[model samples]
Target chain A: MGKPKKEPKIKRKTYIDTWRFLFQIGAFIAILVNPFLNYYFHVKVIQGWYQSIAFGHLWFVSPLEGIEALLITKIIYMPWIIGMTLPIIVALLLGRVFCSWICPINFFYEIMDRVHKKISKRSYYKRKPLFTLPRWILWVALVGELMLAMIVGKPIFVFLSPPGLVGREIMMAVFFHTLALEGIIVLIVLTTYLISQRFFCQYLCPLGALLAFIGAKRRLIIVQDMNTCHQCGFCDRACPWGIYPSRGEAEGIYCTNCGSCVAVCPFNARKFVFVGFTPSSEKLKLEKVPSGRQ
Target chain B: MKKENTSPKDSDKRNGEISRREFLRVLVGFSLTLPELAHAKSKFFSSPVHTNALRPPGAVPEDLFAGKCVRCGRCAEVCPYHCIEMLDIRHGLYAGTPIIYVDKIPCYLCMECTKVCPTGTLKPIPQEETRMGLAVVDKYRCITWKGEGICRSCYNACPYKDKAIYLDRLRPVVNKDHCTGCGLCTAACPVTPKAINIEPIYSFKVSKR
Candidate 1:
């Protein structure tokens, strides 16, 4: 009987959140140990935190910090330019993946979200205070922060950024044997988790705003196949940002490419596709997929 | 939950290019910030000098330090002597920036902080070229200068002892030309309200503010 037509191996799908969680954990540990490595072990390889980090003489500065430094100082510092290239390029290609994958603050929020879910028995998005901010407010906030930095004559957000502050706290605790009062801002941001899961990322956070601005036309994006979608709200529920992948609302600027929606799709309708390539070929590829699984 | 369908035109109108609402928001943000900018002439955000607090060797001019420093803490991390300490929130705009409390811990002039500074906030320079500040012996407070006792504490502690500090008539005299302001003399001063203090004269232009 032709060897009983060996049963076609059914591939089990894995959630993308698994990879994302692993990355988040790795990033957190890296930040925690970076100062220790530099101070105690004399490892000169990696230095600094998320604000501006260096890898063995190569530097990488956050676009927001670089821009603020540029506006206030009005000097096109070479290191700032060299440091900003990788992040800007990554933003252009991947669409805010730094927010989802590397930001230490986001990792903390993810953990907080789990605890929140266990206690409340519902998603944070479903709670009250549905006051959604217009995306344009991000632009205003960015402009406002720049102006404040110029007036203040300092990188204002460096003092207030949660990830930077977290790293600074660790560094100071290690070197100085004390915590700076700036940890209060980190505490304040963390406490806001009781209100909403990603309140800072959505309404505040100029760094996220700057990244979203750079990644507005990102190449890698979540594209929905309408034919096979079945109008299921699973992706909508799965998205932490509250963008509706089913209703074609997942735009590049707001979407962090966390792949949560892709993970939760039971029908496998949502996928990360390079949309900037040949549109016709992409459409053909999407259409070739069967409508639904038996 | 009711699912509301967003048409392409609706999404485009809300998100595409610049809209009237976006312009209005920008206007509001500008209005809010412009007044603060005008008020900043009072120097509310500038770094103010604290007594006994000094920047590391090879530090940029005080005026440019705040704007240039990213506060990455690498300067503190690399200091073999661990003399660099980041300022806390109480320091206002200079919070998180590095400072050496000369009385608590003096810079040894190892030049390591300068080597690791990524921002050029602390410019790289040779050990002898470091011009943190000029150490000035407070004659009235000094034991030798005040004729309390012929104390050679500061002279003995000075890194460039014979050049930066010398005993004239068996009383220590600081030569400003040679003093690199490493602050070892200040830390070694055997008196409360230290006899030898770094005046931070090099940073006077901004520190005066």
Candidate 2:
């Protein structure tokens, strides 16, 4: 008897992939033009201008805080404010495509990962010791930041901020303060980046930790059709955050929703499915297939 | 029989040593840059002296100190010019919070440093409202009043228009009422120990209105 043939998988482009590519290109242009824009317009222009204004002040350059400030300040009709908040709601419905595809830092990391892979010739390993350290450290830092803000009546995060550092560097370069102290800080940050991939986001970013905590649930994840997985492990290899997709739904704490796994899955079985509230019975059925193969 | 690979613990120990070395290197580099960072932070965080306090009523604030005020100098930079700078010394504070020494340099009221502050540390006061201190002219060295010679430099520089220092028969007379205490006469005086000098105006306290 002939072996049963597997159902043909459909191949199509995901919105997540398109969005991620476009955002990365946009960020690059923004970084390049920030100086001229700031000088000519007399705006404290940065990549996170919308977020900064929303936050009442530039608080650590994250859109999340800016969104929180908007909610607190009750400023309506801000397009960027709307843009930032919509994705979280969408994440609840469609899963964390925002982290994987929309975050500028994540986009930078993916590009870095490709370059690292090409240079090293060794396959990038997942679940390294340092990889798990960031989430815990970030949690601790967030608690400390809140306490310090209360005690000092000042936003302490602005001092050691990555985005602030980036803004200061751009300002120094444009204004010819390259010999100034802000210029030196830019050099230190660049050196740190050279040592590790996504050093700021994966390890030190309190904002990323906060987002991950909010999105940590198995129901909202990218699922695979086990019958078509083929154990090729393409999804596992493609995961930038070091998630093992073949091991089933993501743990959610580490997943940034960058959608790299979904884009690179050759079998086209991977689907970002929101599992909470109501579990997809179809996914449960697919999970019951025998371990070795179809 | 092939040799088995080392466990995760063994590899972790080796990586730990490398990371420790890197941490030390970063710490050393940070320490080397500490002095400059402290200076910049302190400059941005300190409070500035109110030079308008030395001026008389209705006197223009900018006429006191001239070219000497580039606004980039470290005086305003380290003034602790913030809301917090005020609150720091509010409770039975011994002498008031730090302000500029307007008697020596006179508050030119340039507002240059206020424009460059990143954290709004130095609140930008308008050129009209920034009162540092009232100016008091010393009559001892006045050429017109003391009969040293005919020097009307102070009379010419005074922006009050009616003249803070008027010449009465080639002798200088400071009209205390129209003087405005701007200290322009003091800065423009061509005498050692300054024939005209600005004294701190203690009576005209800054009213919020």
> On a 0 to 1 TM-score scale, where does candidate 1 land against the true structure?
0.82
lDDT of 1 by residue, A126-244 (tens): 44434666767777888889888887678798777888999899988877778988898888887776656677787788888888888988888777765555665777776776566
Docking class of 2: incorrect
Shift in Å, residue B183, candidate 1: 0.4
TM-score of each: 0.82, 0.51
lDDT of 2 by residue, A38-141 (tens): 44553443422212221223222244443333332233323334544554555445444445554544555666666666887865344233434434676776
TM-score of chain A of 1: 0.86
> Best-fitting candidate, measured by lDDT?
1
Which candidate has the top score in TM-score? Answer: 1
Native A-B contact fraction in model 2: 0.00
What fraction of the native interface does candidate 1 get right in terms of contacts? 0.57
Model 1: per-residue Cα lDDT over B1-209, one tens digit each? 23345465476564557978889999999999987776664445555555567899888778777777888887887777788888877766787788998888899998987877766778788888877788877888988888878788888888998999999998888887789988999999998889788877776565321
lDDT of each candidate versus the true structure = 0.77, 0.47
Which candidate achieves the best DockQ against the true structure?
Answer: 1
lDDT for each residue of candidate 2 in B1-209, tens digit (9 for 90 to 100): 22345565565575535586789999999999999787756644432233323322222122112101111111222222211111111211111112333334444445543443321223355654443444455667676677667877877877654455676786666665555454556667777767666554532343221
For candidate 2 chain B, which ten residues in a row score worst on lDDT?
B82-91
